[model samples]
Target: MLKIDTVFYNKLLKNFKINIKYAKIKTIHKVIIGRKGKK
Candidate 1:
């Protein structure tokens, strides 16, 4: 049971990290598009 919990925790952390990366990229893309619109 302990081992299973640990594995689940690791997967959750990995998914969280990936989500953060994707969010950052999305924000950056929005910023770029905003700048182009301003021009």
Candidate 2:
């Protein structure tokens, strides 16, 4: 089951990276919106 464990770990790591990237994008969008609203 060591192979399965590695596969699962890789998937989890990938998902974590995707989540962080999505969060960064969302924050960037929010910052832009906020700046626009300030005008």
Question: Which tens-of-lDDT digit does each residue in 1-39 have in candidate 1?
Answer: 999999999999999999999999999999999999999
Worst 10 residues of 1 by lDDT: 1-10
What's model 1's lDDT at 4? Answer: 100
Model 2 lDDT tens row, 1-39:
999999999999999999999999999999999999999
Worst 10 residues of 2 by lDDT: 30-39
lDDT of all predictions: 1.00, 1.00
- Candidate 1 is scored at a TM of 0.96
Supply candidate 2's per-residue lDDT for 35. Answer: 100
Enumerate residue pairs that collide in model 2: none
Off by over 4 Å in 1: none
